[model samples]
Target: MSCSIKRTSSTSYRSGGGVCGGGSGRNSSVSCRQYASSVIGGGSYGGGACSIGYGGGMSAGSLAGGFGGGLGGGFGGGLGGGFGGGFAGGFGAGGDILLSGNEKVTMQNLNDRLAAYLDKVRRLEEENAQLEHHIREWYRKQAPSVSKDYTSYYQTIEQLQNQIISATVDNNRLLLDIDNSKMTADDFRMKYENELVIRQTVEADISGLRNLLDDLTRTRSSLESELESLKDELIALKRNHEEEMRQLQSQTGGDVSVEVNAAPGEDLTKTLNDLRNEYEQIIEKNRREVEQWYEVKIEEVNRQVTSSSQDIQTSSHQLTELRREMQNLEIELQAQLSTKNSLENSLAETESRYGCLLQQIQGQINSINSEEEWLASIRCEMESQNQEYKMLLGIKTRLEQEIAQYRALLQ
Candidate 1:
């Protein structure tokens, strides 16, 4: 028997029994073509491993450990090309040229057995190719997905955004309201201050008027004292006049008449009586004039006091009214302040409540994001596990088929 190279249209294989990278064909790049069905791995070249694995179809699919679908497509190339072109000397006496005549029978039996193994290998290879094709199609068609549709979540996000916008607008409105309230409070405070100032001014005027009234009273008292002094002086003058008259009368009652020279003494007692009469008339006129002047001054002072008292009473009433108004204003201002404070407190509470709500919403959003990430990771892990299961299933099925084929071939 001898070895020969023949080309086949449906398949090409390398013939050898050496592993990859352990032979003289270390850099050999071989290719195999299986043009039987879907043309997968057809006319494909592989590096290193193909040199010893593919051997003109002599090396079975197991030459590259196991047929791993298209992932091991290069094994076919190694099987068809590795040994036929590069494993002649490395395979020792396994070459056809080294067989003796007696060894032909043994070789024939081995060849038959190799043929059975090769048949099993071919079946496994075809299945592997089919599985590879199915897997490729699945990979090409199957969409890698992390999660389901999140349209509802998007709508929820939009709703949250709308809520946020509305909240912002409300906050601004509340701020405006607060500003208005503050301005109103300020205006009222200013009015109260101005009114207070006016009240103080009115109080000062009232105090001044009271002082004037005191001065007027003092003037009236001084005038009354002067009138009393004038009356006392008049009484003293009259007493003295009476005493002189009595003395003069006593002296004339015992005196004898005597004529002095020169016009008969001109009647001295008569002249004295005329002088006393004139003096009494003048004193009575002075008394009348003083009494009239005093009465006039008293009447004028009374009139002034009455007018001043009326004015003081009017001012006092006005001051009382102003005080009442001030009190009312103060009350109203206090009420307004209380209202403002309540409004501010309500606003603060509202802000705190909204802040908590917003924080909760943010937490929910973060949780949603974290959950999404966790789900994505789980999805990826599941997908990876599924791929591994499929790969292992394909390998297991192929190995079982190969084992069954080998058993049958042995039997």
Candidate 2:
């Protein structure tokens, strides 16, 4: 059997969050933050391995040691007080004093492997240093010092709110005025309708009076025709009496004068005169009665026509007044309708303006949500890194302890 040993000045660490590693068991997480120091080294058969991490600020440190055979070999693996040291070894079945050629070759191979591991460690150190520098730069960039000018924004918001409130109040006042105007117009319209009905009724009555006047005119014409016929009858009677008297006088002129004793000549002429006077008096009385009756009927008809004319005049005057009033009412109603239309236009503009403002506010809220999600992802990454650091520190501690025990055994 042969023996080999390995050592390190600092601890080693493996990290696995999304990283895969040995034995299919996920690698432990690691971090660069300073809290403790760990030292570790181990050797195993068939390429078994050990790892450790040193957790401390990156301070200047060094490691130096030697190994020998015999009594000097026992003193070789001692530690100095700068950083911790580590050792790893494997033993094969062989004499203690003599090394086989194969064993020498194995040792040489191990030495070469250790040299390569050291080079890799150096490269990792440089990379870690670069990462730390980048993290510091990033911390500076993301510092919470550059605050936004939210004070100005708040003032702007308050001003907008006040304007909106004022606009709303104005809109309400306009609406109230519009309602009042509409009601006034309606009242006027109703009055106009009532007056129109009255005018129509009065015109109908006037037309009725005109028909009555036509009937009276026809009656007057009939009475005048009857009076002409009576006058013609009186003329005819006087002419017939004159002709009979002439015939009687002619017959008496040829008769002989016989001395006949008569008591007295009958006064037939005087009797005839009295009878004519009585008939003329009766005819005059009847004529006066007819004239009085005609006068009375004419006066009554005139009174009815006069009353109808007065009523018609009064209705015409009222109709004129009502027409004027209706014109005024229509004008006022048109004005009110125009005012309502203007107010409706203003209301539509106000609503459109508010809708645009609401859309802008919603867009701002969406942006804030997106920023919050990005910040949360960064926080998760930082937590994962911190956990890796702790696991690496634990491994380092165990390795230091093993090295100390081995040193004691050599003594």
State every prediction's TM-score relative to the real structure: 0.47, 0.57
User: What's the CA error at residue 5 for candidate 2, in Å?
Assistant: 29
Cα lDDT of model 2 overall? Answer: 0.48
lDDT of 2 by residue, 183-215 (tens): 766776676677667667666765775566566
User: Model 1: per-residue lDDT, tens digit, 250-311?
Assistant: 87676598667766447655776687677668767766776676677667666766766676
lDDT of 1 at 203: 60
For each candidate, the alpha-carbon lDDT, in order, equals 0.49, 0.48
Off by over 4 Å in 2: 1-197, 235-297, 383-411
lDDT of 1 at 93: 17
